[model samples]
Target: MRVVIVGAGEVGSNIAASLADSHDVVVVDVDPDRVEELNYSLDVLAIHGDGAAIETLEEADAGSADLLIASTDHDETNLATCGTSKVLGDAFTIARVKHVGFLRTWERSSGAFGVDFMVCSNLLTAEDIVQIIGLPAAVDVEWFANGLVQMAEFEIGPESHLVGQTVQEADQFDLLTFAAILRNGDVELPRGDSTLDAGDRIVVIGPPERVYQFATTASPNDAATDTENVFVVGGGEIGFQTARLLQERGIKPRLIEEDPDRAREVAETLSDTLVFQFDATDTEALERENFGAADTVVAALDSDQENLLVSLLAKRLGVNQTIAVVETGEYRDVFEAVGVDVAVNPRVVTAEEITRITREETTEKLTFIEDDRAEVIEVEVDEKSALAGEMIRESIPRLPKGVVVGAIAREQELVSPRGDTVIEVGDHVVLFVDERVAEEVTSSV
Candidate 1:
């Protein structure tokens, strides 16, 4: 597949890095340095020009592209690029935007911008935070098979019950499958003898309820089942969306914005939410609002520095959980070190979504878990596939290490895979794969 990506920024570069080995990836950007960097680092073609221009698309051979992705930071530019690509080529078009209005417009009228699919960075980031808020120990969560199965990553702290236990010993949850473990930047398949250690990140997949229960038990802190109060800083799209999503779940969150106009807009948009027009970073304002009583605080300011400050202040004010939206991936660790519970990177989330859409033709669903160190994928079994008509135990030997079949959907029924369970043709199979052998796992099944 030839994938032409517009804008060689974080999102574009990430998508290119992931797809370069498997497909023909071409990236376009206005900055010569960005193009040069991509050309030097990745095995893909990079074009230096305005991606929305026809000549730039033509130079990248857009007509031959299987998919054209517009991921520039500017919403208008991305929309224009996708629309122009549709007019210039037969490739399927995808646009990344920060505003939700574009998504609503596209949904109301198909082909409005010639965009077959749209990815909203703010909305995606907000949804991710909501998922994290629901699950206690999950740093990241993704769903597959129409939400029937969930894959979550949990960081093992020193106080965790499973810190020193072997994989078999920690197999107390009948519905949960320990997929893989990442320790000190290395990926390891969780075998019966493999012992979990403090600071290790474990990926687990199972029913939503079971996964939530396991996460609560594994977390270092006492996990709360219900969040009574949530304080959201920033009146930007991400913050507003997060508050709106929480409200939809019957959680009325208090939102603070420095700008009165934005605060008024948010108040008008969300009737159930409490809107405060004041500086969220102001210590006096935070104290006046009794912010310490909130169960969770979300920092979604425009600047990473501001978000970091908000998260740190929230922690200082005695908030139980702090979730910050960090635009750049490099700031994630820094934010976490300063006491942020979870740092959500919108760029990484958008890139992962685009990559999944690009691979939708081959896999039913694909989720990058554990900081892209592992993946959970859903695939349909065919007669030609290696696992077709084979028992789970027989096929286990054929698959590469660090891969496990978590569940199977047969004729609208969910089946918990066992050693004796046979994988029949036409059955939908869900598997957790280590990044090192993801390609091998994908090809085999």
Candidate 2:
């Protein structure tokens, strides 16, 4: 498929790179240097011009394109670019808007701008953070259909009561299903006989209330043998964000901040939380706070080194679990090497979400595999979809090679879909596919 991507910035470039592997991608950027950089770095066509201009879209042969993605930093430019692309290409057009309000108000009328989709980075990023915050038990959470369906990630701990049980046994609650397992960053299609070991990150899907109950039940084991106290290192935005999230969940978080004034400000803002004005790198100060007694320790400091150090120190001091926030992508390996249970990078998370939305053909980012060979995607079954109105078993042969339906979301409920399962219009079907056949499966559906 011919695709036109506007803006060659981080988000735009990532989206273009992701799609270029499977589709014909034409990237447009105002900066000649950026265009040249992208051209040298990836196998994508580059056009250096104003993406918001109709002339530029024409030059890129937008009219014949299958998809147009506008992902500029400015909300207005992105909207205008999408509008222009829709006029020129008359194809599936998506825009990345900054303000959440723009997304809420954009398509108020039938005759509004012909954008097929609108992605609000701020809203998406905020929602990603909020979901993690709201469900502190899960390392990550994905919501479907206005929060009716939820996918959650949890790590199995040594003392977890459900460690010996299989997915089917643990999920006998009748509402939840173990969707996938992330073992050392690899997605595993766990069967009924598969046993969950300590440190394995398992993904579960179910309704909101059922997911909540599972999270609550699993957290006590994952977090620690018992929950008594919490310690957070850093006074930065991430630190405050993490602290606020923990506090809201009734887990009182004690933060250790190096900057006295910043610590005071955070303390004032979150009076309910205990803010210790001390250097996180100072082991003595951390020890004074009885870090050993803390159930879990979180490192959200500005410097990745400090965060890693704090996490290592917490772990060494007998903390059951340690989570840190790492900014640099290169430091991810180091986070794991230091025995950190979870290390979150906001930029990487945000970039992935943005790219998922921008390059979406039929499905969203489902699951990542270890060998980078397969993935799971959630696709909205359109009226023209091959799977629509067809029984799951009947449609298997028609589906693209290396792809199989894993689950289905219909009417805000998750169904462990089988061959007899019939797909309806608007149902979001989840499929597991090898990377090579992703586009084929998506386009076919």
Predicted structure with the largest TM-score when compared to the true one: 1
Per-residue lDDT tens digits of candidate 2, residues 226-257? 33477877877666766777667677778888
In the range 1-445, model 1's lDDT, one tens digit per residue, is 8999999899998898888988889999999998998899999999899999988899999988989999999999999998888877789999999999999999998878879899999999999999888576668888777778888888887888888899998888866888888887787777899998987888888888888888877874757645878899998999999999999999989999999899999999899999999988889989999997778889999999999988888888888778899998998988876678889999999999998898776689998975677788999999888889999999988888777888787887677788899999988888988778887778778
In candidate 2, stretches whose alpha carbon ends up further than 4 angstroms from where it belongs are 1-13, 22-41, 46-139, 154-175, 181-202, 208-230, 245-252, 359-376, 380-382, 401-409, 413-419, 426-434
True-vs-predicted CA distance for residue 123, candidate 2, Å: 8.5
Error of 1 at 102 (Å): 1.3
TM-score of 2: 0.69
TM-scores of the models, in the given order? 0.95, 0.69
- Candidate 2: residue 241 Cα off by (Å): 3.0
Instruction: Provide the lDDT at 81 for model 2.
Output: 85
